[model samples]
Target: MNILIKSATLPDGTRADLAIADGVFVESAGSGATVIDADGLQALPGLVDLHTHLREPGFEQSETVLTGSRAAAAGGFTAVFAMANTSPVQDTAGVVEQVWSLGEQHGYVTVRPIGAVTIGLAGERLSEIGAMARSRAAVRVFSDDGKCVHDALLMRRALEYVSTFDGVVAQHAQEPRLTEGAQMNEGPLASELGLAGWPAVAEESIIARDVLLADAVGARLHVCHVSTAGSVEIVRWAKARGIQVTAEVTPHHLLLTEQLASGYDARFKVNPPLRRDEDVAALRAALADGTIDIVATDHAPHPVESKEAAWAEASFGMVGLESALSVVQSAMVDTGLLGWSDVARVLSSAPAAIGRLAGYDTPFAVGAPAHLTLVDPSARSVFSVDHLHGRSVNSPYLGRELPGRVVTTIHRGVPTVLDGVLRDPQEVSRG
Candidate 1:
């Protein structure tokens, strides 16, 4: 459908009439085009999540590619890099291609499958990186996200190998030895609750080592879900030293903190568990100063049975895709640390560049691919499961008042979401 968005606010705070036709942004819309009153809405570049767990090809009970894509679209995302660690793991060319095809067939969001850096994600040896990269899927970002690549030699090899193709090795920086039986952020609260502590050093140490190794190998490295103040300092230092490194902070870590675990609500549970308020403050500062490159959902999902168990036995993840943008609005934009253009940079263009996804650098420009979202920044309401469009209901922000709503999301010139309602899959695919 040709689209004419009237009086939409651009990221730079200017108002304009935006036009989309034939799958690209155009200078004007024809008379037959669909007209959308975008008055009072901010038109942002479609968001790109560098890290997301769609849980398909194996964990469909949690989230299928189609359902996850719908969830992403509802959150104003145009593209999400689905993490490896599936049933067969996206380690081979066949698996990655299958995931890529599923996303295309689903037709809601661009699902770029992340190839596993190790076989079976066992950290035993490297996976078929070259084959997956060369495959039709064209996998570029590689990671064993659920499991950190603890072997320094293997980490070095993975970094060196991806650099040959100008690909990046995204590391889940956690030292295995220090985090045994860890449940939450290591602190007094853990002692009070009798839950095992996940020390900050466990995360910071590995990141420090990996950055040095990346520098030594002269390869690009991206750190996933950095949660500690010290981790931010290390990444900032690395950038100052001219190391090829980029880091991301999850929305949960930005607005929520370890105190939420006081009641043992497993919904608060996540890998690289929530940190102190000081950590959150530092993370916001780093992002504002451009030390943190982007915000990723790390949108892990699980069945009701998985999270309803005892805190110690429950799964460690929170479904974040549906609530990510609102959280960013509350934590960053409302706080006056960032403007809408910066939000576009962190949530869209930067992540797209890091994942090597093209066509996003010049967002909303005429002739550019028409992947964009319209947001009502004045909307404020308590978040609920009704806001979630995925198969899972594991979000942590339920009942919390959030500041923004994604009124419309256009993917490749198709309206996946319109007037705050997610379109049906059939209708979306037909477009």
Candidate 2:
């Protein structure tokens, strides 16, 4: 299959024609190629997410790899690292391979399974880290998300073990005792709302300890969903000290504040809950200055029953895959904190590098894999459930007007989305 994208604006503010054939970008399109007129569209390397939860093998009512991949495609993503906190937990070679195979079979997006750091995510015994790395899935990232690896010995061991395979240990970074029964960010807002507060120290303290531990062991560590100003300073300090640490900030944490919880809307209720306006400002600055290496959509999806209940009883997650890029564009790009080139780095290149996904961070060049997205930067619309490609409708920005829309997504030279509509898999494969 050959496709030519005409008059497309690159992220660097230059316009050029892009040609793809045999699943790779080429110098020119052969005769009789499919042509797409991309006037007024910004062509970027396909976005990559370092963290996503595609609830499957246990919680299919919420989401699956196929559905989540659709959501990723809708957001202009070509690859996503699926979290390991599923039913059976992606801990073993068999389970990780199954999840990886499902992504290959679906062919919507590249799904790299994140293996659990602990067996059954119990935080007691280590899972088959070496085995998972050696598995067909080639799991390069391990995490015990939804449950922090609180045991210092275990955390250290996990970091040391993965270092042997050039793998990274991604920590959820929440102190269990400090965050027990926590509902929202700890501050005057939680007091005013009469909800339990999740203190910043609960997150910052864990990050502080983990950074020192990572530095001591000379291993790679990644912090997930960094939600506080203090955590940003700590990561900055760690990096200054030459520690091998990387951190990510979620879109919700970047745009929304703890004030949203004032309405008692459970949709705003998330783990490491939204923080103060000052925290949001600090996170945006950190991302701009490179303290935060990537923007990840924790992309958690929950059932209606799980989200429509009392604020305390509702699940601690919001669906984010479909809205990630729009939120970043609205909060970061349009606000002058970042530009299109920076978006490509934060949303694509850096994430691919942190996840060790080879050949993904490469810029658009002849012979590179044809994985890219076309975005309409001028498009603006009030979001609705109709835009959701995943099974879950737990998005926090449901009625908010967000900037930009994904025009087309080409993964491996195959069109998964064209003109903002998801293409049929059968038709795409036959192209």
Candidate 3:
């Protein structure tokens, strides 16, 4: 199929007409192409999420690749790196290939599976890192995301092992000992609310240690969902020294603060729990300055029952894929801290570079993959369950007004979304 997108504003503030045919951009539209009037919209490279939890092959109650991919499409993403915290865990070549195959069949978004750093995520022994990397999925990233790779010696060994294949170890930087039984961010509010506190140092301590380890071994390391001011400073220091370290900040961390915890609403409960206002400020600044390499959703979704529990017993995640771009626009672009080009770098280009996903950084050029998103920048809406395309209804932005609704998303020359509505792939296939 061929498509013509007319009068769209590029991220660099230039207006142009874009054409796609047979899944690649072209100089002009082919005959009988589907014409779309993209006037008053901004065209951006399709987003790529480095951290997304598509709970399949085990926790289908929460989300599956098919459902999660729809959520990603709704959020204007062309690709997302699925985290390895699934049933049986994505620790082997077979599991990674299964996930990769599911993504291909869905066709909603490209799903790259991240292999687990340790077998069973036990942090004791390394998994089949080389085999997974060499598998059909071509896994280029390994992580123990829900659980930290706590043992120092084991972490170092895993880092060195992946360096052999140019793979990066994305560590979930939390010290288990310090955060045991923690419920919310450690502070005066936690004490007043009578909930357990998760200290910032718990996350900061592990990040500091891992950055040094990465420098010592000359291995690539990626920090996931960095949530503290201290952690930001550490990452900045490592980068200044030319350490091969890249970091990601979640949308929740950028827009929401620990103050939301006062209501005891379980929807706000998240891993490495939301930090203070100062931490949010630091994260925004770091992202704008290029100290933080990318903006990852950490798009964890839980079932209704799982999230409805008491704060102490609730799950530690929120559905984020569908609302990531709007949150970024509200938090970064609308505030004048970043422009559209910066959003493209953090959301699309930089993440692609870090994950080593080919052909994504060259967006909207001739012969490149025709993966792009069209946004109505002036459109504003109150986010509600109607906007959610996933199985889970645990979005943190529910009831919050967000800017810049995604008008359309084209993946490989196919329209997954049009006119703010998601297209059913089955219906399109039948046509």
TM-scores for candidates 1 onward, in order: 0.99, 0.99, 0.99
lDDT leader = 1
Q: What lDDT score belongs to each candidate, Candidate 1 first?
A: 0.95, 0.94, 0.94
Per-residue alpha-carbon lDDT of candidate 3 for residues 142-192, written as tens digits (9 for 90 to 100): 999999999999999999998998999999999999999999999999999
lDDT for model 1, please: 0.95
Candidate 3: C-alpha lDDT: 0.94
Runs in model 1 deviating more than 4 A are: 425-431
Model 3 CA deviation exceeding 4 Å by range: 426-430
Each candidate structure's count of clashing pairs: 0, 0, 0
- For candidate 1, which ten residues in a row score worst on lDDT? 422-431
Per-residue lDDT of 372 in model 2: 93
Candidate 2 similarity to native, TM-score? 0.99
Q: Which stretches of candidate 2 lie over 4 Å from their true place?
A: none
Per-residue lDDT of model 1, residues 10-72, tens digit only: 999999998999889999888988999999999999999999999999999999999999999
